[model samples]
Target: MWGRLWCLLLSVLTATAVPGPSPRRPSRELDATPRMTIPYEELSGTRHFKGPAQNYSTLLLEEASARLLVGARGALFSLNARDIGDGAHKEIHWEASPEMQSKCHQKGKNNQTECFNHVRLLQRLNATHLYACGTHAFQPLCAAIDAEAFTLPTSFEEGKEKCPYDPARGFTGLIIDGGLYTATRYEFRSIPDIRRSRHPHSLRTEEAPMHWLNDAEFVFSILVRESEASAVGDDDKVYYFFTERAAEEGSASFAQSRSSHRVARVARVCKGDLGGRKILQKKWTSFLKARLICHIPQYETLRGVCSLDADTSARTHFYAAFTLTTQWKTLEASAICRYDLTEVQAVFAGPYMEYQDGVRRWGRYEGGVPEPRPGSCITDSLRSQGYNSSQDLPSLVLDFVKLHPLMARPVVPTRGRPLLLKRSVRYTHLTGTPVTTPAGPTYDLLFLSTADGWIHKAVVLGSGMHIIEETQVFKKPQSVENLVISPKQHSLYVGAPSGVIQLPLSSCSRYRSCYDCILARDPCCGWDPSTHACMETTTATANRTALIQDIERGNRGCEGNRDTGPPPPPMKTRTVLRGDDVLLPCDQPSNLARASWRLNGSVGLSDGQGGYRVGVDGLLVTDTQPEHSGSYECFAEENGLRTLLTSYSLVGWPEPGPAKVPSASDPSVSSPGQLVLLRGRACRSRWPQCHRPLHGPCAGWS
Candidate 1:
């Protein structure tokens, strides 16, 4: 009973262990095969838009108010930050009036019309006020505007100074702190008996000295020192820098001489200080006089100087832009110089002198020369009222910011020297120029622009800098003269010859990461929403299972249809002689199976017996004679089955042996008498055999 119980338990366990049909094995159909398909989902709705219309001279962003201000040759426009669409943030709002346009142009076709050859500069002092200057109308002026209204000031204030001569030039201006500064060229009254020598080119005569700064001929650029506290007695200072020709040694060809020019000088004055009162009262002072050689001919009368803050860490340094002439040709270059107010004051205190060694020094005035002084600070006589010369000079200094070797550096000039981070590129486009920097740990982004319509971005990195990427942000090529990067949202604003452009840094990063992969119909290394990670399609394992199943099914079907046909006909038998040959007939009439023939009882020849051939006749026996006689049989085979014996035959010839003979013991043995006796031999039952005579004599009784 115990053994039987154990056997029953085993049977029950085996029945339960059948595993419930493996839960249908979850077919591979659920995991679809990976086939290459176009990624339409990734590329559905990218947007592009038309940029601004006119070229721009300056770009400023009021982050607090969400407003963008752009300045062009003779126009200033505003844009609301909220109005910016995808790639369409550069729409224009308003333009400067004809009266304001005239200020930018230097050469006018008509008396009352504004000049087209205008030198215009723009700066934003605050959200509501922007300072602009031009050589048109031949006078320097400043105005305040409402940011929301986009309208110019109804009230105008004239500048303190009168227009200097050198009638064909323009002016550039800047706003630093609360003051406005400009760079311009002013002409001097002719001196009698100082006859200018005649040169080969029929040039105008008069030994007038040309300097970067003079009471009559100079422009100033300004910036607010937000990091520094405003002092009680010091005035808000604006700075100016330019290049000029050094004094000639007795007029030997100023053009032929190698060291004929220098980076002239820089001057600073209070915002309220202007004209002759502040200038003639000796209120303005000269800073560093750059001794480096420069070209004087290219910048003799008309030129440009620009300045910007260097680094965000410290605001003490500044960068200046100027044109340097090499071998009589003008090449635009920028200088990164260091300055301190204490160092400038030390030089001014000692240098009551006019000329340093034999080289002509600027900012000096001796009675009675026709040309403007090299570095003297000048202003309009009327605007200088109430300005005190005896007031203590403000300590305003500028310096260049240098970058470490490990840090990425900009390909173009920006600030003093841009810190250069990773993946930054200087790109030229139709909208405006931009310098882009990729996102990093400390800095959000860095941006820069150029006069040739380009924008570049760089990301800060510990090692060398990288140019992240670039894009065509505009429709046409425009001069991108100035640019500003917003601290609030890290957006880039560009000033072009046409207008202003604003680009969000976030948009740039997205475009760079997915643009090409989405376009080329390739598998994207992109974030997967379901998995929340980058994933790749599994192709290898999927293909292996599919291939194996297909091969197995194909093999099973081929074997099932192998042998399902009818039987074939028999093959004819053939016979052959020893010394000669005989013919063996092996005829088959069926096309389904082959036929085979056997000689005697042994397995012999077979032909066309496997359904491969039809209408096979017989086998040939060449030269058949005595020994070529035998029993033959025929059979057929078809498909996988074979026929036993369809035909049989025997080949025969006349036998040459004795049929009858007598024994020698008989009475006839006494004599040579022939005896007749019967002897029998059996042949195959199906065919005939012949009985015939023997060749030699036989002793027998008849």
Candidate 2:
């Protein structure tokens, strides 16, 4: 009975087919801080300017002389540009008077802290004098400082609208012809004032009717191009940016559904405005406003966070930092948007809207327009007609202009797309510098600061934007109040409540490998072959320069290794006892990419494949035996490029407590929080990181 002998032999083979460890998958681990970083130690060679590290809210840089001015609670400092954060920086202490402090304390304000003198505005008054304003215990005050002596050499002036009563209030202003121009709440937050805060000229605000402002939250201001010698027809203009709620007067619409939503807006006033002839005296006759658009199609919104000034040379471009969030919350993501001057001019030059009497609505004007157009600045032609200011215009024309100061149209962004956007980081302040690369291409280097004391260095690319690097600016988490960039010094100055940090534009030396250095995509960085390290020098040979590609993947950038993927990692071994469990990690880098695995030239492990199973931690093998012994490999696939991770060999059984396997997702992928899940590495329902530890299907990693 040869057939009986054959059946018996087959049964023997089955008896020896020992299973691997039962699949006891480890829990997924998470990575919270995965961004590449430059520690503070590298910046040791510096002359640092040190302040009290308390609420340095205002930052002003006189770029012409490289002098930096910082305004803080009860003190103002003038720091050397070269050694800005150095301890020996010059400071002038000017606190609130005893009587003013008492008044603030009576108002329920913190006298020792919040009720002190906080400088809110500091601008160049003249070549030798500086204009500074402070919230003197809720009683605003202004003073003139002598630049030569760095001291406040003049007595304080009563500054109601020139400075905000609350140090935390949002406002913007500029000094023009020795006059302070501002859009702010005059004496209290309830009375919003858009006025020229100068002696002998007074203009107050009304809370209703015309409603020229909606308690405008001011951001920044820029003076229109005005060179005394040149004779231009139009009067100089100063524009301010803010966000306010829409009403029937004019806006996207006074939609009942969007009663709580607010729209970003920009308003401008003529420099030579002298109020109206009879009805509106000492007021801005040319004050007009329009909406700022940075909305997306999916009902997503981008609200202005801050703005950079416009170019005086007809460049017609204005830059602003906006955060994209749910239309209701508006804080999900942040981006940089550009506004065109052409759009501003178009809205101003378009048809005006009128307030309908009985209907209580703002409707497009179909009636006759006032002569020379309402809000038209005093041009050479108007001057020739003997009209020096709005005081010369007829009363009817002035009244019409006042009622219809809001533009009928809105100013949409130059394009719907953003120059730069970040979903992971909440940007507070942003400044950019344009520089030409040695490779013959030019790009803007954006220095964006965050709320948690981090600065993200990014560069604009043709396809999109890439965050090149990030650095910590403070010892603790603090919002970056201001960011200033200096191209001449190749540095970025960051101001926070804790202190100021100066950072280099590039840190090429940190990248030791040629592959990593080129993948950074920083305009200031390039690969140099002379020293073998990632040198900062711009010199690069044509052949070596061509090696860089696909920066988002950090691939295709090594000599003779120009493939789209990286080679498989080196191999290791693991010993498992019979009937024991083991994990084969498959998490690679790039959460954007998924992972897969191959075993002993067999198909992917799945049900019906014995006790072997795929998990987020690694491949878990239960009841190990001789058949479980084989070669196993882990690979990471991202951006359509497949990268080899690591390989391992499973041999004979060993004395076991747990299978000598690690619970960690490999750190090879360079992503933080959690490594990419290897073949069996899986993400649980609650764990997005897929990097937590799994104790036993019953134990922990050995």
Candidate 3:
């Protein structure tokens, strides 16, 4: 049966493969051809293919293995680069069955009702191993998809302990050195009562058992050191960025006033002691205390943090992204701050060394400096003032200055300051770029995902210098919580609302790799002996609109209707008005809610009542006067929503006058016989000659 299935799949692939240019078209020859400079028409003979219609929430790329992992709305697909572009990429090597059934199925429950597992984060451990986390599937899991057999290996392990809560909040994953680490939404007991807890705290904790992941606390974000030796030494640390209520404060106290709410924190655990069978026994040491600072206190909601290499010269320097609500601007904006881990450690230790009175040293112990607070290290005095322990307090220090010991005093230089980079919009989470410089200068690139479905790429050009790039990868607006990049393949994997998109660095103009080679027709396009494959350049024709259209077509098939004519015309309306009552007539059907009534373009009637009552009978004006003899527009609003407005002018006044009486004889004239006749003395002349005619008498009467 398996052999027959394999044969059927092969036959399907062969039938789909049509004769055309080879899938691996030479980039050099394609670039050499004269291309149109026009914005819309640039390529020729382009072939387009659509992947499965599933909406992906996360994307992961494995460079060493040359594989792309796309995590969609409820299913997962592994696609090869050779089968991605053109019509030839119709092959889907593997796919996770759509999670349609309820986790714990019961009788009478619909099994195919789509219990979607929205995959949010993906981390590549090695060439074959892959780790992924999803919402429906609350457990942390790792799977090895066989490259040759196109089947997932039976290596699923439940990560329920690490990711204890639903992923609706946010989560991120990083593969530092050998062990896989993830920063996920965790539930923990509130601080005051050890037995009964109310509110959950967002705390940074390691994957180890009892220490951080215990029922007492939850982790917000985690970072693992990439170096093997560093992974084992003091340098090999896992930093957790989270927000938790102060240990001493109660819920009522913190909740009474918004300012006393939960504060941001960082905790670190040494990697050396984290990976053994006794993992749960290890304890996490406190590193730094950071609070959400914003001008508007109410808008501040502690989300999550991302750690990035501050300067290219050293990997030890790190920066963090935090979300805060402030009145100074919109609540949706996010603020970021930079802190040297070494300096954070010092501040965490308090002003212990500063108040060196000799008699009683604050931080000094009888045994000698009680294990220099976990995150503290001695630095210049100016750098120390930048730390803010209060939630509403903003850091006074603008930037950090590196001082030289050779000088008599601390030399503060503004050129190389380490500070947090600010962004206009708020982002729920941030992911550090995976590029690390061991021997020479390091390149700092940080990826941030916004709540409005955008991926922001930030690169530290130098000390206190940065560049930001934003790209829209999702059609519908959905929150982008996590992001990951594969340095080996130079591809950016973004986790968005529906699914993931693999953005090749070659597509970015800054990289100057494939795009530049393609434009210049250089030898950079051919296959390289090292990778034994053609240089991959994503054609511009592969766009969201095309993909959406293909998906829609596949779903609708040939019976789909096509629009061939212009839209219908708008409806017409008429208005009528009386003394104080106005009638508005609408001819078109509508679903509008609220209608606005404007009188002579001056006073307008809305939800507020002034001198008018509006209803289905039209607008009713209580008192009628001559002054009100102007154009009165009556607007009808069903609900609070806006609707079509129509108006009529009552430009006349009521007057008193005699009433008209009808006549039966002469319909046109009434009471015409009421005229009085007078006879004048001149009529005496006419009396003698009445038969002669009344001309003389009429002359006298005239």
Q: TM-score of each candidate?
A: 0.41, 0.75, 0.45
Off by over 4 Å in 2: 1-50, 198-209, 224-236, 249-254, 257-261, 274-279, 296-309, 323-336, 380-396, 417-426, 439-441, 461-464, 469-472, 529-702
lDDT of each: 0.33, 0.63, 0.37
Candidate 1 Cα deviation (angstroms), residue 635: 72
Q: Write the per-residue lDDT of candidate 2 for residues 392-469, one digit (tens) a residue.
A: 987777777778877777676554444554544576677776656654556656777776877777765543456776
Q: Which stretches of candidate 3 lie over 4 Å from their true place?
A: 1-55, 80-100, 103-114, 124-128, 132-150, 154-156, 172-235, 246-260, 274-313, 327-330, 345-424, 429-448, 455-470, 486-491, 504-702
Tens digits of per-residue lDDT for model 1 on 1-702? 534543443333223221122322221111111111112233222232224334465556677777666654445655565443344233322334566455444344343433321225445656565654333344434456655556667664443232222233334455444443444543224221100011111111112222223232243344434224433233334444443444422224443463644324444433433222222232223222322111122232213333334222133333222332234232222211223333332343222223334553323433332112212232332115432431222221110000000001111222112222111112221121122211111222333343344444433222212223333445565555555555454355655554555555433113111111121111112222232222222222222212111111111211222222223234333222222222333433223335666656685653333211112433333333444355555554533344443443434334345322234354433223211122221111211221112211111101
Whose TM-score is higher: candidate 1's or candidate 2's?
A: 2
Give one digit per residue, the lDDT tens place, for model 3 in 1-702. Answer: 544543443333233322222323221111111111111132222222235544555555556556666666455666553333423222222333344233413323333422335555556645655555444443334454444444555655444433323434445455555455554444322121011011122223333211222222222444444333432223444555555443222234344553445545454444332211222122222222333232222333545555554222134544455554433343234544444555443434342221124632112212222322223322223135542221111211100000000001111112222223233466666656533221123445666666776665554433332223355556567786346556554555655544445555333222122112122221112222232222432222222112111111111211222221112234222221223322232222122223456767677864326435444334444334455556655443321222334545544334344322223243322233311111222223442332224222123221
Question: Best candidate, TM-score-wise?
Answer: 2
Error of 3 at 49 (Å): 9.5
Q: What is the lDDT of residue 676 in candidate 2?
A: 27
RMSD of each: 36.5, 12.9, 26.0
Please report, as a residue range, the 10-residue window in candidate 1 with the lowest summed lDDT: 398-407
User: Which has the better lDDT: candidate 1, or candidate 2?
Assistant: 2
Highest lDDT against the true fold, candidate: 2
TM value for model 2: 0.75
